[model samples]
Target: MSENLKKDYQLCEEIGRGKFGTVFRCFSLVSGDDFACKSIDKRLLTDSLDRECLEKEAKIMQLVTGNPNIVQIFDVYEDDSYLHLVIELCNSSDLFDRISKRTFSESEATAVMLPLMEAIAHCHILGVAHRDIKPDNVLFNEWNLLKLADFGSADWFLGGKSMSGIFGTPYYVAPEVISGRDYNEKVDVWSSGVILYMMLAGIPPFYGESAGEIFEAVIRGNLRFPTRIFDSVSPAAKDLLRKMLCKDVSKRFSAEQVLSMSNSCLILIVLFKVEN
Candidate 1:
């Protein structure tokens, strides 16, 4: 821990852990406010590329803090051994945990997705791409509002400059990423599609016994809406998925376009049900 961190805050408890670091619940001494502190060890970031990504993640978080749906970073503390990030504390469970607890109707999913897409669009508009957009990275605030978290995979993407690395959770990764082709922010849209599919169907769009099998399925780019799971889902919802999960990156809908259509889609679904 940094001397500054020791002076300013008191560590409470370990809240979460991921491949990159451990997150702790902390209380600010001066403000009496609570925060999430991500402690990343310097030794684990020995690779130059990893270190660069770490720095960029912090910069991206700093750039996009004020957005209502994205997690906010308050302060940063560094020491010889670790880098600590003091961010908005979200005590509620992540979307994945919530989903595992129960199923979500299309309407409920839309309610969750609209703000998500808006936040994503906000990030893209600001030139940031959240390479990881899975449910585990989506947290709920005390108000029960969804907040996008974990910018460890986030970076700024300038127009006409595409990224080539394949970085994302397996089930939600875009096909182009699996193919090792250059991709852009649309990759996030594809991940959103996977999330949508999972939300409505209670399982990922692609699944297999092994990671290799899952990657093969993803690369194949076949979307399955099994009658048992999706027969009750709205056509408009399915249409949006088709557009979002398109194998051809050029055919994929942007976040702005999706947001424009999502409201109308939900409204139509509601009307159709009422009429029936």
Candidate 2:
């Protein structure tokens, strides 16, 4: 807990709420800059493990703070009853809202993904794995640039080491994770592929009425690019999705590889525009 937090910021109206706490729009008393402040109630944390998880989230946010593609953390405040996280204020809504409002064109979806992949690659370079990468955690700034947010499930991953846990949203969980197998950062790549699929097709590739059913589907890895929705999608984009959504972790593309492939896809799009 920082001593300066109380003196430095003024909390405004609540903007959002979750199981842990409420998020408020805040302003820095010194700089007059607006930010988002997440207030987590200490009482809601059932045990020491919960407290440790919250602290870990804050540390991971601090680790990846500089990138424009990720939301920046300004400070953390803790008192007897609550924990506060002062972070970048993104005025625009999350990706889920945008997708619900209307389907994104393939080009528009690619544009959204470019910066996202960059952020993921940056996190990987720093040895951080963002286990949760759903549309709800992907926000757009006022400029409409995508910024990855919500690091509550993030963890530090060392190379060649496997993390064991069935963590992550059911629809986007990697097959290895669903099978309760040891997994690494490639889990994020699987989630990214699910995001890309939903962005293009306007639905998740693996979805069920219940989490258990979704887990089964994920483990089965039954992927499809239905002609009704994906017929017009470029083969290059589908290829990338296949590589990303691969059931085998060893075959999945790394964030860096995805970025490189995305660059190639962008080039092809440009060439087609020029030729036509």
lDDT of each: 0.89, 0.88
The Cα error of candidate 2 at residue 33, in Å, is: 1.0
Worst 10 residues of 1 by lDDT: 155-164
lDDT of 1 by residue, 1-276 (tens): 889989999988999987778999999999899999999987888778789888887889999999999999999888888889999999998899978887788889999999999999999999888999999999999999899999888877887678878789899988888898888999999999998888888888888889889999999888878998887788889999999999988889999999988989889889866876
Residue 141's lDDT in candidate 1: 91
Give the candidate number with the greatest lDDT: 1
TM-score of each: 0.97, 0.95
Per-candidate alpha-carbon RMSD to the true structure: 1.0, 1.9
lDDT per residue for candidate 2 within 124-192, as digits (tens), equals 999998998999999988998789999888878876677776678888888888787878998999999
Steric clash pairs (candidate 2): none
Reference-based lDDT, residue 238, model 2: 89
TM-score for candidate 2, please give it. Answer: 0.95
